[model samples]
Structures are given as C-alpha cells and as structure tokens.
Target: MTHAHFAPGRRTFLASMGAAAALLPFAGAGRAEGTSTTRRYVGLYFNGAWDVLLGPDPRDPAQSYDGIDLGTDALAAAYRDPIPVMMAGQEVLWGPTMASLAPHADVLTLFRGVNMNTVAHPAGRAYVNTFIPPSGVVPKGDSMGTRMAAAGAYGDLILPNVSIGMPTFNLVFPPDVTGVRLDRATEMTDLLEPLGDMPLSEATLAALRMAQDEVEGCVHEQYGRPPVEDLQIARDRMRQLLSNGYGESFDLAADADLKARYGITNPGASNDPAVIAATVWRLLETGLSRTITAQLQTGLDTHGPEWATQQPQRQQAGFDALAALLTDLRQDDPNLDDTTVVVFSEFARTPKINGRGGRDHHFAGSVLVFGGGLRRGVCGATLEQTLGLAAIDVATGQPDPAGRVLLPEDIGATLAHAAGLSHDPFRTDPLLDWIA
Candidate 1:
C-alpha cells in the first residue's frame, strides 16, 4: 500500500518536515487526440537565497574536520559519534518541512555548494537566470528561456520553451526566434491596435490561420511522410488563440475555492511563496506554460528575533506547499518517474548567528534537487555545524566536488542541465558539475 508520499530510500525521512493536504486533482488532456508523443523535460527554477543550516545538512564532523562541534540533532542522531569524514550519512538530504517531496528523491541530485556573491536581489536574480553576473543595463545575458527558444528550430511541434512568473524568462532570447510567450491575457483588439493592421475582427483571425499554414508548409517539406498535419492544426489553433487574446494561464478566480486553498488572494498577492509555486505547477501541468519560476518573498533579511522565529516558519510553509505539489504530481504521473523539480536561492545566510540575532547573507549556499530520475544522498558538503572560513576543507566542501565555492552563474548552469538542456547552451559560464 503506497502512502501519499510513496516513501522509499532516504526521501522525506527527517522528522522536521510536514505534509500538505492535496489541493486539486491532476488535470489531464484526456483521451482525445492523435499519435504518440514522447516525454520532454519540465523544470522549475526557484529564485532567491535559501539557508542551508536552517534546513538539511549532511556532513559528519569527526572525520570531516577538526574541532567542529556543529551538527544537527538529525545528523547527530542518525550518524552518531565519530561520524566518518567525507562520508554521506544519509541516502537523501532533506528537512522535515520537505517530507511531502521525499518519495521522488531517487532521480534527484542535490548540489549543496550553490554559493553566490551577490546579496542584492536584482543582481543575484540576473546571475541566477543567465550564467553571467549582472553587469550594467542588460546586466546578465541569455537565460534558459532564450536558449530553448533559439533551439525551437529543433524539438517537436510544441514551442521549445514557455515561462510563468519571472521576467527573466522574457529576456532570455532574441525576440525574433522566441517561442510563444503564454501571457495570462491576450485580446484581438490588442493585436490590431499594436500592429495598425487593416484586417479587422474575423478577417484578422482568418489571416493569422493562413500565416500558420504557411509556417507549417515550410516545416512539412522537411519530412518525407505527409506532414504531421495534426501538429499544423495545433499551431493554427494556437495562432488563433493568440489573435483572440485573453488566454493567459488559467484564471485563479475560476477556481475560487481551489484558489483559496492554494492561497491565492491574487497573483503575487499572497506573501506565501507556496501559493505562487502552486500556481506555477498548475500552469505546467495544463501545458499552458512550460516552466515555472518560484520566487520566495523578500524582506527575509532578518536581523532580529523576528527573523529566527518568523522567517523559518515562512520557509517551512513554502517547503510544505512545495512538498505537497510534488506528492500530487507523483500521484498523477508516477510514470513521470522522470519528472524533475528544483528549489534554489541566491546565496546562504551567515554561518554564525549575528549580534542582531538574525543571520547576514553568506558566500556559501545549497540546493534541493528532487524528482525526475537520478541518484540521492548528499552530493555537496553539509556544514556539520561548523561553517564559513571555519569549514575544514572549504576548498572542497562535500557539496562542492573539490570544495570549490560557487557563484550565481553556476546555478543557472545547473538549472539548464536539470531542465535537460546542455549546460553550455549559450557557452556562458561553466555550470555546477552536479548531475553529470
């Protein structure tokens, strides 16, 4: 009998994690259409800085470094005394808050050393999206969205990429070759006024369909068999939708009850990052959107008791919501044994509690990688209580292959890989070497 979390291995075993009530049933396209379609990768790139020590840490102090007393009660209880140095004490690394996501850890791979330098959210956001640090005006360059859009020439009929939430997705590629941008709203009136076209109303719709046929005509010539007319039809309909407008991701209001459960006072209205995350997943499952960018709330730079007591709970809520989403995804598509999900942040909190009772941002951080197909257990070093310059071999932390500290660019690279794109898509900075 499989419980809601489908437990096995080291997933969701920690005591600190919590479970979320299932929100809505999975939405499928149903048994309508055509031939077979192969599975493609779907990814989520969470933007922000999430503290490692506050969550899951997997390093054994005794063998890891000298005079290191820092360790979690979980790690301490699980690993015991004389914990082997550099040895992974657990098969999967997660906090009790993430229990709902544990069952799908097998294909997951966590990169603990996702440290970055920028504490400024905007700059860090740029660095996280594109593998380039924020510079001047354009700050960073080609993010995953642009990379996939350019590669749209390849792949199946579906747009190579699409996004929700983050503006970074909008800036990823050159506009000409970009894939369909699924705005939550579109209107036929919006199209004509912008283009100053003579064609009005129904005429405009007809013209758009004709253009789609032309695009498909060019595409069909490449194949020997009759063109996948079915795909061309889809393209035509999508073009029509674009012309008609107002087809942005599903309306949160339509599901007032579900929206309330998912905690949607409105988009970005709820301070709970979980609600935004759930909305992102809803879009992805419906195929209305391809990728989801989950960003946690700002103002977490807690420098007082308020931080310790308040911030942790917010993160817990975010994690719990994320966990529940994962549980739901699994229940719906256990076949998506390959479904991959990610949680990341700009940088880590300070290694030690500051005089202000709050933790300042730090040079090191970590990542939580789950779902899809892969290996588990800790990949990077878990501070084992000791951190900062005090970390034994900071040069090669357990999370870092050789204790190599990381930058924001590494996260973009890692996300590109996790989403099944080549890390060198844009030949930007090198990606973190976690998966391959």
Candidate 2:
C-alpha cells in the first residue's frame, strides 16, 4: 500500500521508484536539464554487500574470477579482456552479466584492491560513507556532502551530495550537521527545512525578508562571494516539488513497456538491481542533486542452503536490471555522458567454489566504474585459474612483487578525487589515482 508520507520526524521514503511512476508528471526527471554547471559531481554508495560477478550473460564459457587460476585464462582472454592488475591482487567481484558495462566503459574509471578494516557489512559501509563510525555519544564526522555544501556557501553551483534510499547514519555529516532521512527516497526533499505558511501578513513578510537577509549575509561573509539567495531559494524549492503526482518525472508507470522491463513486484530493493539503477538515474536527470547513490544489497555471504540455491537467480536478476538501468540512463539523460556510475561491494568471494556451489568472501573483489571521462578498455591482469588471490600494482596495472591487497583508502581517495574534494581535507595522505 502507498504511504501518504513518512510520519513527521520519522524516516521519509520515496514510493514507486519503478518505471511505472517515472512517466508520471512529477517524477522530477522531466525538470529542465540544466547546463553542466548546474549538474556537478555526484557520489554514489552501493549499499549492502554486492557480488560484482553473476550477471545476465547466457554464454556458458568459463571465465576467471578475482585472479583465480581457472586454467582458462588464455581462452578467457579471447572472450574477456585481460586485466593485468588482477594477477598482482585487487580484483573485484564479477558474474556472468559483468560484460553489460562493456558499452560504457570508456567514460568510466575503475578501482580495485581497496580494504575496509572489517568484513562486516554495516561497519564497512559506515567507514566507506563517512570514513569513521559512531562511538556511543562520541559523534562521527559529517558526510562529504555536508562539508561540500558548507564550503560552497556561495551557492555557486558545487555538486550536492545525495544518497537515495534508506535512512542511513552515513548521510549525517559534522559540526552537529546531519540530513533528515526520508522513509521514501523519491520524496527526499520534504525532509529539509520547510517554508512557513503562505500569503503571510506584512509582519510575516518582513520576517521572511529579514531571515533571507541574515542567511545571505552569513553565506556572503564566510564564502567571500556575492549573495545567492535567489539560487538557494530556487534550489530549496525542490523539497516541495515532489508532492502528490506533481513531480512525476521519476514515476515509470507511464511507460507500460519500460515498467515491464524493470519489475513490478518488489521493484526497488537490494533484490532488484534494475530498480536501484533506474531510481538513481531519475535523480540525476532532475539536475537538482549531485552525488547520488543507489544501493543494491543481499546475497554476498552464503551461509545457508537457501542462499546457495537462490544466489544465482538473484545475481541474474540484479545484473539484468543493472544493464537495463544503464541502458535507460544513457537513453534518457544525455547529461550523464560525463557522469560516473560505480558498482561496488566490500570484497570478492573466495577462489574456490564452496560445496554449496557458492563462493565465500575473499579480500580482493572487483568494482566497476562507468562514465566521467574514463580511460576505456580493461586494465589489470587476466582471470584466475584456481583458488588463490593475486596481486596488483596500481601504478602500472601489473603485478606488485610484494603482493598488493586492495586498500579501502584507494576507493575513498578515488571518490574524493572524482568529486574534487580532499580525501583528508586536512591533507592527511597521498591522493588515490582512480580518477586520474
């Protein structure tokens, strides 16, 4: 059933993130596609533990996984491009549908060999999102987006950090700054500061003007740039634009065919990859948000029979959905031609397929990057033949004699680099090369 809106002060969630509602007038995708200056950097978090492999491809040809010695590296090279880095370590997760990204690889940047101290899913996600976790009353740092907004005080068009789906503490940034969570990801804007009652008396109008002047003055003094109350208010208008079906740009129900292509039942969940992709694409088209993440969860750890039996089906569905979503994004929003869409997970499955016909979690898994001026083609080493992880040299996509284990910092640094932020705004470590 459709929920009217999240209870006040509770999580706000976006409903009908499927193709069915996208065609509706207020999905927001139809909002003017502004110039590149309007759409800046967007960060995405692939929530949940996702397995990179297990795609929709139908070919039975065997392939290398996470630098395993599958013995078919030579033949596999013919079907799958050789990734020299996988041999040295830092291979990402992959399944049959991995090739779906082949068409858009040129405009993307890839990362491998990243580490998150713990293998636990939630802990790892928090670390990836905010670079630290909460310790009881000791509050964690603010999210990257909050810092961006604070820094871009001029409203001079810096990218907005956006996270879609779920109420995540990761969205919370520093200095007691935190984002309001929406139970519905689509109606996300409602969670922000609300406008006062309309058609106010002269006294109320004077108050608004005073408030605006104060806000403008503060931003101007701090940013050393001219005031932008106009732009900020217009952008702030986004919060209310999603009421009812008025902002149906994200609704896909308008297109019966597209809706069918995505999925109707449990359409936008960790179980449904396409739904995640499509929802994210809609956000991008609005030209109102930057740094949007569409998380795909479930199926990475196979501890029981149900997971073992259902893993393949889930993988296939997710992969197919992902492919469809990417294809649609390219078709719908030409603006994303320079946008980078990444598919990531904590780690890869073990080299050896377990007795249950499932793979266990391994340190080295694969991550995919699409768009944003990529180098194109595959890098790193060829597929593996058996059950041992390989090494990688980030500098040359060759083997590192000491053996390289993917470090989480690499991915984190790469993301910061992509969005033009300092991994350690405090200048902590060397920069990562995922963007370069």
What does candidate 2's lDDT look like per residue over 372-401, in tens digits? Answer: 433432334323443233466665544575
User: Highest TM-score: which candidate?
Assistant: 2
lDDT for model 2 comes to 0.43
List, residue by residue over 297-383, the lDDT tens digit for candidate 1: 445556555555555555566666666566556666664544556566666666555676666676566666564333444544544
Which one wins on lDDT?
1
Error of 2 at 426 (Å): 9.2
True-structure Cα RMSD, model 2: 10.7
